[model samples]
Target: MSEKRPVMTWLTDMDGVLVREEDAIPGAAEFLRRLTESGCKFLVLTNNSIYTPRDLRARLAESGLDVPEENIWTSALATAQFLSDQRPRGSAYVVGEAGMTTALHEVGYVLTRSRPDYVVLGETRTYSFEAITTAIQLIVNGARFIATNPDSTGPSPAGPLPATGSVAALITRATGVEPYFVGKPNPLMMRNALNRIDAHSETTVMIGDRMDTDVVSGMEAGLRTVLVLTGSTTRDQVERFPYRPTRVVDSVADLVDDIVPPPPTESE
Candidate 1:
C-alpha cells in the first residue's frame, strides 16, 4: 500500500506548478507536451473562479503551455456541480464574475439575492462592499454559504490579493456562519474530478506547488501527491504543515521522466 500503482491519470495545479502571474513557468510547456503525448488522463486545476476553461486554455496557450479547454478544471465548475447535486436548478446569490455566473447558469441555477438557496462567494478583481453586504444579508436570512477555495490570497503582478477565503472570513465574522469550501483541500473536489474522467485514485498522481491545498487534498482522496517548490509554498515552509506530499521535487521538470512511461519499443 506504500507504493501506488502506475500513474494512469494526473491532476496538476495551475499557478505555481505550470504558470505564475499568467506566465508559464520554466519547463512547463515541455511537461505539458509530455503529458499530451503520453496519452494519460489529466486536468489542470485552479482555485480561481474568474474564467472558464476556454479562457484559461487561451491564457495558457499565450504562455506557451498549449493546454486544451477540456484539460482545465476550476473551482467554479466544482462549486456549480456541488450545488447542482445538492439541489437541482437551485437559486444562488452569486458574488463573482462571468466564470461563476456561467457555471451556475450552465448547471441550471438562478442567480438572485432574494431568498437564494445559497450564497455563492468566489474570487473576483473587485470585491464590492455592496456585494459583501448582500451576501451577508442573504446568508443571515438562512441561505447556505459556499466558497470556491480557501486560499486567503492569490498571486498577482503587483502583489498578493485577498481571495475567496479571506472574504468568506469577513462574512463569517459578521454573521457567525462559516462557508463550505468546495475547492482543493476538501477532498470532495478531488473525488469529483476523478469521477469526471473515470479515474481511480490508486492510479492517479496529483501534482501541485502548495502542500496545504493540493497535496493534502490529493492524499486524503487516496492519490499519490507531489509537491513542487515553485509556488506559494517554499521548501523551508513545508515542514510547518502536519501533512506531507508523497514526493517532493524542485518543480515539474523533475517529474517528467518519473511519471511518463517510455514509448513502445520498435522491436516489439
Candidate 2:
C-alpha cells in the first residue's frame, strides 16, 4: 500500500455530513470546531444551488455549526465561476432562485430573457412553467444550456422534489440541447473548489455522505474520500458501486477526533 500523506486540508459536504434537514448531525459541531482550532484549511461543499454561502452559513449556525460564509461553497457559485471563466460578462436567462441569480450577478452576468448567451438552470422550491418555457425557447434559438448541478431531485419536508436536472431534461427533450452541468460528480466542481481555498488535492481529504457525488468527485480530483451513512448513500449501497471510499463510518460523529492534529512528543 502507498504511504498515506498527512491530511492538511479538509473538504466536506454540508447536508447529511453536518446537518440533516434543519438538524445538526451528532459530532458535526465538534468536528468543525476541531478543524477550525487546528488551523486546517477547510470548506463545506454542497450541490444544492438554492442558497448562497451567506444564507447557508446562517442556516448552519441555526443547526449549531459555526461555519463562515467563505467556508461554504455551493454549486451556484461554481456555475457562476465557470461562466465567468468561459465567457466573461455573459448574459443568461436563469430559471432558478436568488442564490443562482446572485452568483451570476457577482460575476458580472446579466440576467435577461431576450436572446441570452446561455440558459442557466438551478434548484428552486417553486418551478415556474413560464420560466422553463422561456429557457426551452431560448435554447432552441441557439442559446447555450447550462445547469448548476445534475441532481434530479432535492429533499423537501414532504419528500423529494424535482430539481434543476429534472427541468434540464425537459428542456433537452424540447430543444435537443444537453445542458452542461457544473457540479458533482463532475470533477470540475471539485477542482474549482480546491482552487477556491488554494488547497492542494494531495494533502486534502474529502468527507461526504454520497458515494455517487461526493466520493466519486473527490476520488476523481485526487483527494482521499470518506463516506458517511447520514445522507443519500448507505453502507449496503457502497458495495453496489464499483469504486469505494477510503473509509466508511456511521456518520460525521466518527470523524471528530481525526480533524485534531496529534500532539508533538518530547523529541527534543
Q: What lDDT is obtained when candidate 1 is compared to the true structure?
A: 0.90
The per-residue C-alpha lDDT of model 2 at residue 175 equals 91
CA lDDT, candidate 1, residue 46 = 87
Q: Look at candidate 1 and give me any clashing residue pairs.
A: none
Model 1, 1-268: lDDT tens per residue?
A: 2364678888999999999877888888888888888888899998889999999988898888898888888999999999999999999998999889999999999998889999999999999999999999889899999999898987777888999989999999999999999999899889999999988998888999888899999999999999999888888898999988888889899877765653344995
161 Cα displacement, candidate 2 (Å): 0.7
Stretches off by above 4 angstroms in model 2 are 261-268
lDDT over C-alpha atoms for residue 44 of model 2: 95
Write candidate 2's Cα lDDT for 1-268 as tens digits: 1377677789999988999999999989989999989988899999988899999999998998899999999999999999999999999999989899999999999999988999999999889999898888898898999999989988889998898888888989999999899999998998999999898898888999988899999999999999999888879999999999999999887887777563443992
- Model 2 C-alpha RMSD vs. true structure (Å) is 2.9
> Looking at candidate 2, what is the lDDT of residue 159?
96
Estimate every model's Cα lDDT from 0 to 1: 0.90, 0.91
